[model samples]
Target: MHLTTRQLFLSHVVLLAGSSASALAAPASKTVSLSYIARLYSMRTSVSGKKVVMKNKWNNIEVETNSRRAWVNGVMVWLHHPCRKAGGGWAIRELDFKKGIDPILRSYAYVPTKKPNMVVLDPGHGGKDPGAVGTRKVYEKKAVLSIANRVKAHLEAKKIPVRMTRTTDVYLTLNQRSDYAAKVGADLFVSIHADSAEASSANGVETFTMTAAGCDSSNYYGQSGDKSTKRGNQYDAANAVLGFSIQSNLVKMSKRSDRGLRRARFAVLKNAPCPAALVECGFLSNPEEEALMIDPNYREAVARGISNGILGYITLVNRARK
Candidate 1:
């Protein structure tokens, strides 16, 4: 009742062809692990069932299976695809590694930053614009101003040279902020705000760099066909370097959820004159995080984390230059 050898061989060939066609129809993804990545870059790593932690002299990464999230240094980053189990351990899609993770790692360790000094800090929403509202009526604009002021103090204290679009409570349009940054010849621009969502359960620290050419933004519906460069497009690599530097520092020290690096085209960032990013420090709607943001001490910690991230980025740039 068994088929002859020739018949069996023909059946196998048909199965192989079908499998190949199925693979071709879907997004291509190859399983990869921390050790594999570490080997490629000569990094030291440790592994557990759910997480892969990699470290070198200058950076760190934490990848978790099925989490759709990873931590590079201290910054929490969202993966394009969740890690999958392979060979009895956690692994990431090859495409995600190459496009999402590798670029960030390389820039952190090697990219030469154009700006050694001159930073423009924009505290998001002021005066008429309260941005997000939280329990106890905590206005996001007020909290952000506090954080931005502290960040400014820290940067200036470090001799990095600082300027803010608005020194006092008043409304500055996104165009005004971007224009002022250009007028002052900024080397970098950082816009800081707290986040809010309809889902109260959502809480975390997320950082956003401008959307790159031919890439969909963090917001899924962002179009991808426009390869033409925009003002912010010129510094895509630098934006990653700067964005991750601050993000890692914040997530590491703030001890809040690491929402991950994201892409957006906010007016301030889209028209920015230099490498720019927007920092969503935490969710204003989450009660626990809301309590923290409202506290002066906790807000200081947030500032410290962001300022340290900026310093870390500066260090990367300076080291690369040398």
Candidate 2:
């Protein structure tokens, strides 16, 4: 799909919605029709086979019937629950609308009241925990720490106060990371790490926010039955905005395959004191990405991507305040 320059710009506008609160309060067991969403956004809707497509001059949303997969503006986003048939129409769960779609579509209503005063950066793994080990002895912990330091430099250059959970090769538990962020009064938290999989072909970058309450994680793909709520669920909307920002910038800067924004219930995210996102830079198990992780230039690119993402989110919040 081709997008004009104006359309691209419109996709980034963080506008407000009038009935966001009521829409968010819809029951978890209930579903919202795609037609309603189209009307809310002033977009036209059509059905082609199993997919429902909604589009305006500026943006487009495509959702598969009876599936959790969706695409917004050509970017794939995983919904918390699958879309299903409701009254002869396709609909998604209320939680998915509140935590996933609405925030991405209208972030101004979801942003924090104040601009972020401080950002806490957590580099995954440390001394005792090697994280994912790749070819040529490349370590995920070391790579992420280097990247985090670079990101700190970029953010600090822009006069943004930044702090890290650990500066060196020291192991810290997940609880300690979240606790430290809370103690420091962080307005935003970002955890960085590389991924690993048995299949070396699994490559690309993805960002994760806290999974909504009473929903399965993106990784589980609706298989898990865990529906427990977490403290981080309070920032579900903000998480989506932040995650989308990070993933969008990261993919643009790294020029990597877009794995889309996703959701998970990691300890750091589930207990985060503020809006948070966890970024998987790339898969260490993939030979190509593993090599790229060890390169200084590549690391710089990734850092710039993450820093720009944070700045983008801050800009949205500042705009919302105005």
Candidate 3:
């Protein structure tokens, strides 16, 4: 029987999930060896101090021994658990490999099987809600809207359909933003924002996806807060793929510090109607980053990064369809 694109995609997701259940449930003793991963990807492996570097012709992965930090093509991606020494070698939890590295490396197996029909770009905060106010008086809402507009332009140039939660300066509650995405049948949703912190030293580019069921969020509050599953957990695997794609290209294009692909239970992410990610362009509290936010050239670069990341995800979906 011939299946529609959506049906085929659902079937593929089920098959993939079932096939990996055993591996995912494996005990700590059965953690995946870095050596095995290197061999699987045909990458040469070497140890440098406390880190292991795996390099292939096309990609490179660096895992910090006994740490949750890892880098793929120089973009930092946090692991669910720290790499540990098992069976006389460094290995990572199976979930980390499946949900983090593998998805980014082999996205065709994890991303949606159908190309996205519509991508919703959410420029977070507006109108009465100015979001983070930089030291230079740059507003997060304005910066993100400008950046989102540029991103929409880039995607449209490639013939990809795009929608915005708010095209102009207007306050939108978190629920309203997500509801709009659902109403418009958004295949993928991205919320853009500028971060802020009391410590001016905190500055970087990061991407957040919904926290997986029973996993602690990467942020401090989440470590002590709820770890319960949410609606977005249904797309956990795909979120990893999309989140990593955005973080990777965003860091490369923005030339910002790699704060790593992170996990959070933000309202927009948790309530998303489809696979989604939130991009923190930079910290508005930091003088340097705040200045960059107001720079036209910087905004253009960030926009390109976000657009490229979405295009990369679309490419993966197309490849999966074939």
Candidate 4:
């Protein structure tokens, strides 16, 4: 689980620059085996429902049975083609196994681009939108705003330039929030929120970045075959890097259920002008987690985790650029 600086779990490859026409047209050149993949990567795997969970010394991942989407470590990734059902097991096409998963896994070797100076922090909800209602009757809007402010304070102490979409309790549409970040020319867009679900046992922290174009979403809300591209698709690599950085630290520092990084078509992230991620700090529906969320120290720790993530991402980008 450790490496030299921003070291990653997978091998490395030089990203080929140019068109993907041949890649798109490439047929399933070979049948790839799941067990082979696990053996090759030195990982162990177990299956539950349609998900296969694999873990190794360096990382863990959950891949779906017949889907190209996989959660690698703390980021959602597209495998380009669906995994095939093979003798009641799962296997992926060699095309995506080589071109899609290989390239992406290699890119995880973190590198820096340039000094990212401006960051835009967005508190998920305000005023009319209470977001999630906790079992303790806590409101998500207030909690996220508090968390965002604490994150800002920590980042400012590091001498990083930071800004907020809203400094006070106010309602801002998703469009407005993203537009404000674009207007300010932010290097990163961080949307903070609390999660809730009918299942009270569902408790954990997860981060989401936009699903790349031409790929199925990780959670699979039936967005398969979505070929239309969006502005946010341009930062797919950066989004994964940033989201993994945040989710990794958050899960480690909070000691909460590791929900893993996810992908979604959030309104605020769909057109984001820069690398963007939406963070679900915790599940308010769970009473225990809600109590932790209400604690100032817990919020500070969460903020510290987020702050560390951004700094890590900045380091990665700056190093990559060099």
Candidate 1 per-residue lDDT, tens place, 1-322, comes to: 3579889988877887787765444444655775788888777888767777888888788888677778777567766566777887668866567555776777654354465678999999999999999987888998999999999999989899999998777998889999999999898899999999999999989899877554556666546555455899777777777888888788877888777888777788789988888999898899888888889888998999899988888877777776
lDDT of 1 at 123: 92
What C-alpha RMSD separates each model from the true structure?
Answer: 10.8, 10.8, 6.0, 9.7
For residues 204-273, could you state the per-residue lDDT of candidate 4 as single tens digits?
8888888766555666656655546788877776777787788878887777877766777788878898
Query: How many pairs of residues in model 2 come into backbone collision?
Result: 0
lDDT of 2 by residue, 138-193 (tens): 99999999999999999999999999999999999999999999999999999999
Local accuracy of candidate 3 as per-residue lDDT tens digits, 1-322: 5469889988887887788756445533347999999999999999888889999999999999988889898889888778999988999987788778998898888887767999999999999999999888999999999999999999999999999999999999999999999999999999999999999999999999997766777775337666677878888889998998899899999999989999888999999999999999999999999999999999999999999999988888998999
Error of 4 at 248 (Å): 0.4
Query: Compared to the true structure, candidate 2 yields what TM-score?
Result: 0.89
| TM-score (all chains, Cα) for each model | 0.76, 0.89, 0.89, 0.76
**Candidate 3 Cα misplacement greater than 4 A, ranges:** 1-30
Give the distance in Å from residue 79's predicted Cα in candidate 4 to where it truly belongs: 6.8
Give each model's whole-structure lDDT. 0.81, 0.91, 0.91, 0.78
Task: Look at candidate 4 and give me any clashing residue pairs.
Answer: 111-316, 111-320, 112-316, 112-317, 112-318, 112-319, 112-320, 112-321, 113-317, 113-318
